[model samples]
Target: MEIETRTPAEQLRACEALRRTAEARSLDILCELAEHYEVSEDSLIEHLVDRRIQPVVPGPTVSEFLSLELAGLLECTPLQAAAKLYSALRLKYRHPTLHTAVQQLDIEPHRALRAVDKCAHLDASVAERVTTGWLPQQLGLGHTAALNRLDKLVVEADPQRAIERERARRKDLDVSLWGSYDGVTTLSGRLEDLDARYLDASVDRMADVLTAEHPGLSRGQLRAKAMGVLANPAMALGLLQRAAQPALPDSEAPNGCLGPLCGTIQTPLHKLRPRLELAVHIDTNAVGCATGSARIEGAGHITLNLLREYLSDIDVTVQPVIDLATVAPEDQYRPSAALKKVLLLAFPTEMFPFSNRATARFMDFDHTERFRSGRRRQTRLGNLCPFSRRPHRGKTAGVWDVKQHSVGVLTWTSPLKYVYEVSPGGTRLVDTGHDAWRKLDW
Candidate 1:
């Protein structure tokens, strides 16, 4: 009945062992359940697999495995449980070593995912470090700091590639907000170094306005209150429109998205002017069919039947895959303005099942031709995957080695070859990028 004391490092190591044990047990139960339902155990312990063979279609990948009881056990909504299951399978297939390391490192699943994102495009040495849990150990220091070390390691491994990757990573910055159950709202999110620095300065400057009322406010409190001020809709919007102006707009215009004045600007958004840029690509004829759906780029897909309720005065950008042209596939890297206009056409709302984030920008302009080794071929060598944004990391991590996957579609009774039959020399829309999201766990 005696408990021995352990050092912090020993405790950490013990915790990691416990985490791995729990994960293994969980996978065992899930796999057994899958067998009971005659399902693929692939959804469980998917990270252990070397290569991923995606589940067959024409049937449910989720409903067949997920139920109310399973959802409750997992502490998530039924849809969320399904999404988690699907995403686990996808990410595991993409990063077998990383997932294993995550369990071994006792890192939270989501944080481990972000680590994978940061380290996905590194040299073999860096990847080997990741597999052995050397890199992830640094994550305990802090997310940003750990990522900085990973970046430095990659740079040391390959300076030129590091520079190119940094440029791409810097170009991609996003700010988002989510609500909590506490009734009180919260504002927090990931921001890159440059933007974070700029926001810090801006918040400091704006907090000065509140100095008279609360002279006792510390720098942190000032920054917090400044964030509250920034939360004001009118203040935020006017700031955007006038960020380029001579002087920034102050607390003048209404503080809401509604008419001239309102407090809760967030609520009346569905009624007020549209703010989001929604791009739809679904055929008009098959509007309300279950088989038919519309992809709202950047947000995923919705049933075509809900089109009336979902869309009203929304402006849509369309990019249609056409029936061939004088332009060659190799020449079509970045679409020209005119070419983009012509490319806008109706496409299937979703390609892969459980794929929710089918954005126009995420589709792959995949070449059907096989890749020939050497001798000056259009190998898509330098190009990055629009979604993962990883390419040429001394291995095929971001880039799949397969030149083409033969996905058959049944037209009637017979099966047709190739993934999609885009008018021989033409192109067709594909959601290859959105099988899993970059920032989102699901």
Candidate 2:
């Protein structure tokens, strides 16, 4: 038997009959059939209605159709497509609700049409979940125009850890204020334990004095003036004392707990300020030749005694020599051997100046240069005495009168050896056999 092909209308009627039968069995069966036929449940119901087959239950209403489309289950009608677009946008982004999500789309019908189109081919469950759960909330985004801005912010915000690291780095910069102190300058060790209270009191006293001196000054301006005055060490000490007094529990007990505070405050001041003294000496050989003999008689003896006293605690031997060769080599004479040896014991052996012929030759050359430079210029003798103006009869000698100028050459022979007393507290040069009143170059 040959089968006849059905017309379009007849085919539609057959599909509707099949759908009704499926619906009568179960809605699940109808849904399954809709999926198998690649048609929406709403579309299948519409087809059945067109064929004059009444649904067992009424077919989905317009609103229900829209809802199904929005949930991404059906996609036949334009109204349903708009609902789907709205639902998908709302659920995908959590922050903005469905209403806000719709408003964000801007383009009226086009936005709605796009949402439905995007959801149409997706699986029913997947489309529904994406619409309801993920797309509805706004991810802090206002519109498509604002998307680029949000993306930039997200990229920039990723460096929070680096910013925190930089903050920590700034804190470290604040902690390293202590300067180095290893004896490369005059301020080493000496300023290590300065007194702060003394400095504070000194500054206060200065301020009071300046205020009394000028009554018209404002307090702020006065403070600035006082700071300038207190830069002096004497004034600084007074100011430190004044600042520390209130902190002290008692006047007599001021030194007790203030020890560490003194160190803490004074460390900075010590670095800012320093105390210094300078001495210069000029040695003249002429003066030495004339006075050296007389000075040496008493000075040498005094120096020897000073050395003995200075070295009392030290185990090293002290020997005084009138001739340099006795202590140094014959060919290599050292003028500062005594001082060099003493310093060598305290410092490194390599720092000592060794006795050498080159040094001796250099000293001799310097002496010769000084002598040539110091010679007095001669002036011509005008009109010799008539009795002695015989043109110097037999020998014809030239008569010239020269100024008797004294040539003083200074020779730095060596550092003087003197006894000096030292304790943990301080050091002082001793006056054993020498006159303590006489000041010596150090």
Candidate 3:
């Protein structure tokens, strides 16, 4: 058979095609061609391309190169394998101690490689054992240098312990845990017998030192003491519920009826309910207050503030609806003649002009000195009805008399204190006071 002597470029292209074919699982054909040509694979490859071909691929990707490298190391002493692995890893991750420590060990290259790989994922102490215990002991590299090298490896592997050690090195220093809550309630306190199981094991572990100092108490007692220390309303409610169980009699029950005490307990917990908290704030402002619904954990402090702002001065009147059907058909269904006062003296007539019907009329006096100069002033038209004091006989005054005295004209008024200017620091009273017809700002 005649073989053609191809040009350099043609040879290079053929070599590349062959390399691709080899990668595609056709290396056996290349091997046969090299054998038939009576030339080494490298020589055949070199003839095609002048560039140096790597004898082995460095890492684990190609199994053939690893096998070749492993076999090469086996020909040398056990220490050589450790040294090679150390050198390889050092080059990869730039660890200075790896090479030196591997050289100092007497283990065979494969044994050292296996040991190091086994301990690679472990923490420091175990990694050190690979070097000191397994490598040196088995490979017969018994030397103080090997032990020292192992120690260095251990130190390099674990940094958290080093940080703790450095922390302990400082003297007269204080370390404390600080918690800030946007909405979550934080509980911190000492307990006589905190149940190790009931509480978070992490938190319990943190309080272990304190718990040890105050021993001889049951877990429940410790938890109770911790609750007492924290004075957490939620925790107290939980404890109360636990105590209220029929199986568990209240050993430390306070001197009071459980209903009232439970009501008192519920007062704070209920206040913690976001809707109830918002409702209370609304009610305080003579506003329409309603807790549509609430989700405990989902509610945040920001939401609470927003709810307060919305309900600040809003007023809503809920008239009692008389059920006429329940009454006798022939009987007169006369509603109560007394006008129900929805709001009265509690309303700030000075701040909010709308508190009184008569004062609300003067709200049109916008250019008054009290309004212009921003002074605290009170309204001249009082919230009291005409019949509240004395009945007026004049025509206009008679209108007020009829409205106040007649049962059909019965009306309720809501009085409110106006806030002209809210202070920057939220200390409202500092720059706010009463003025005639309008609340003033200093």
Best by TM-score: 1
lDDT of 1 by residue, 60-158 (tens): 233233332244346343356554554444335445566565555455555555554555565444554653454445755776776666666656666
Question: Which residue window of length 10 is worst by lDDT in model 3?
Answer: 387-396
lDDT of each: 0.44, 0.32, 0.32
- TM-score for all predictions? 0.36, 0.15, 0.18
What TM-score does candidate 1 get on C-alpha atoms? 0.36
Q: In candidate 3, what are the lDDT values of residues 1-442, reduced to their tens digit?
A: 1245457768898886655443323222222222232212332222232222222123222211221122122332213433443434422232223333434432333333444544454444445444554343444444445455554555566667656654554532443322424433444543223443454453343234236546987675565455443345564454454334343355344542343334234443323322222212122333343433221222223344544554564443434533322322111121112211211211112121111112122222111111223232222122122211111111122111111122112221111121222111111221122454475332
Question: Model 2, residue 428: displacement in angstroms?
Answer: 61
Q: Over 4 Å off in model 1, which ranges? A: 1-19, 27-73, 77-117, 121-130, 133-151, 154-165, 180-183, 190-195, 231-442
Q: What's model 3's TM-score?
A: 0.18
Candidates by lDDT, descending order:
1, 3, 2
RMSD of each: 17.2, 45.1, 33.7
